[model samples]
Target: MSPLVIAGASRGVGLELARLARSGGRPVVALVRPGSDSSELRHLGVEVVAGDALSRADADRLFGSLPAGCDAVSTLSGLAGDGRRADDEGNINLVDAAAASGLTGRFLLITSIGCGEMAPYRSERAIAAFGAAVDAKTRAEEHLRGSGLAWTILRPGGLRTAPATGNGILSADPEMHGFINRADVAQLALRALRDPSTRDQAFAVVDRAEARSVNAIDPHPLLALGA
Candidate 1:
């Protein structure tokens, strides 16, 4: 099997993805930031590469230096402050690097639900803090949609650290709001890497039971909206 390259795999969903991939006997190359703690990944025997994903040259170096023919790529990068430039630039750089790699494999991105026009800000401070990140994710999604690669955009809603229940819901429209466990999200991404039916689809994920119930709530109305 070809190696899987996971950008921002130092922690959270990225780290979980690496662990799962490694346990499944798949080679994993984890991209970490300089000085970022990677003891967890190291403990899992994952190969670690250090670089910032927001820079094209750095991203190129990270991916280029890897062994050829990676089977899949996942970007789990996130933002912490009110810096639109950093978020937008990082996403764009990652997309560009993925496009340049010329690897005919699954390209999966961990984006958030309500990333574009649907992103809700309940307060001015919150809006200011996350506005840039939302725009950046939106742009990144758009780029991936048109990048001509076999892509699957997994947009998760209200990520939590709870245990996984092996169930989740996927909504195509943004009106549905719910929470999802990060572990479940990681599992979904891993599954999509090899699942042919998930290709070329951008889905908003939540707890599966919630999704089914939402689908049952005026199914025709929801279908019409998505249509």
Candidate 2:
């Protein structure tokens, strides 16, 4: 695999994904915000580029050097009160800029389960709490889907800060909902990126148990989780 360009690699699932890629002997170009510490990434030999995912100029600068048809994954998001637009503006900038760069391969996007058609399955309270973020994610998904780039959108259930259980699972059943470890999410992103069958598809993911790794529990490497 060529160097994978990951947006939102400063921390959390994005960071873990970068680690996995590096561990697998794949080069990583991690995009993070300016001023954000990249010590962890640098420690892993990742090439960290500081840029706001919501800035067109920044996005252009990052993607301009990316090779055409290289894999990219974005997990950009803002917290509840950070006053930053993440799910929407953040991802849109990366998507649009990458598309324009003509170097984007299969782009995998990570979003929450309540986004898009899965909204109805969420409780009213949950929706009310995350409604704004969900709305923004939906719009970003729409833009990516319509951007004419090969893309796969993953709407994972609640994310947890636990260690990998490897029991992560994926389903097209929008009604299916649960929580997953950030590491499991990263594993799924790796599988999906290499699977051509997942192109232009979207699905919900969650962990069924805390005993196995996502890839280990579901070993069919070519998009068999939700098949």
On TM-score, the leading prediction is: 2
Best by lDDT: 2
lDDT of each: 0.70, 0.82
lDDT of 1 by residue, 101-191 (tens): 7757878887776675456522365457666666677788788788777788877777788777777655566565577887777777777
- Candidate 2 lDDT: 0.82
RMSD of each: 5.5, 4.4
What TM-score against the true fold does each predicted structure earn? 0.83, 0.90
Candidate 1: misplaced stretches above 4 Å? 80-86, 116-129, 210-227
lDDT of 2 by residue, 80-126 (tens): 35676878988888888888999658888999888888777778988
Clashes of 1: 3
